[model samples]
Target: MAFENPSREKIKELLQQSDTVAVVGLSDNPLRTSHSVSQAMQQKGYRIIPVNPNATEILGEKSYPSLRDIPEPIDIVNVFRRSEFTPAIAEEAVAVKAKALWFQLGVYNEEAAAIAARAGLQVIMDRCIKVEDSILIPSGKTKK
Candidate 1:
């Protein structure tokens, strides 16, 4: 079956309920899209956990080399890596019990989506989380 992203309403709901976002492939460079988007989310009250092997930190949050390395519960696994890299990330997200698996704009992989979906994770692909948040929750998410 062809994969479909969740409805905008569902996306909005997820954004509203989720608090901690683990950004995989998040870059240490401020100019990178991952860094900028994560920074924006952090400003909007989401806790952004940076997951990058090469960096010690990004956006002032300590970076983990992989999803399994993060010690806290993750509400969302927002991926900035390429499509080819996502299936492994999906597996890791499942292992870590992430609430959602989000593939950033231009990143899509059927295998990854299926893996996450089978694990009961809300899966979103080929869309920008930052853009979605800005449109769906322009006022920003409320603190729980």
Candidate 2:
């Protein structure tokens, strides 16, 4: 399946409109990109739901093992897992009705992205949420 990259404008609009993001494969270690990015988003007024089998808690939020486990709606499923594994993850993300799928830097699954896109979900690959937040917010004005 072929999928077009989401336009810059659509990406910006999604980022601005979303508040809760599910960080799939999130780790407990603060040094990890998953942890740091989630923390950054949290500070920026976005609720970060940590999804990992290894972690019981992270950033003061309860961690779920999968998108299906999240009781509340997830605006974005920010994937930190390997690119090869994203198809199943994308399927789960779709089944759970997440509004979008985000793959962190170095993570890109064109197949999975297409599946999500075909399901009417916004798809962003190889972009950092922290970077997006920082770039979108004006200097000296915190989003949170």
Candidate 3:
């Protein structure tokens, strides 16, 4: 079966409940989409954990090479990598027991989505977390 994202209400609930977002493939370059989107998420009060082997730090937060490298529990694993790499990231997210797995806009992988879902994690694909937050979060208020 093809993968489908959860309902809007469910997405909103996931956003509301999640606080820490581990951004895979996040770039140190400010102009990159991954950097911009993660910055926006940080502005919305979500702690952005940059997961990129190349970066030491981004947006003032320590960067982990991969999900397994993060010491703390992750609420969401938001991936900015290409679709081809998503399945592996999904597996790592499951290994780390992430609450949800989110693929950024323009990135979609049904296999990865299925894996995450089977692991009992909320799955979001081809959507921008910052955009979703702005739209579904009541009154555009930043999460605390």
Q: What is the C-alpha local distance difference test score of each model? A: 0.96, 0.87, 0.92
Which candidate has the top score in lDDT? 1
Best by TM-score: 1
Of candidates 2 and 1, the better by lDDT: 1
Screening candidate 3 with a backbone cut-off below 3 angstroms (N, C-alpha, C), the clashing residue pairs are none
- 1-144: candidate 2 lDDT, tens digit per residue: 455667777877788778889999999998888888888788878889999988899999999988999999999999999999999999999999999999999899889998898899999899987887678653413353
Candidate 2 to truth, TM: 0.92
Error of 2 at 144 (Å): 12
Residue ranges of candidate 1 with Cα displaced over 4 Å: none
Can you give the lDDT of residue 93 in candidate 3? 96
Off by over 4 Å in 3: 138-144
Pairs in steric clash, model 1: none
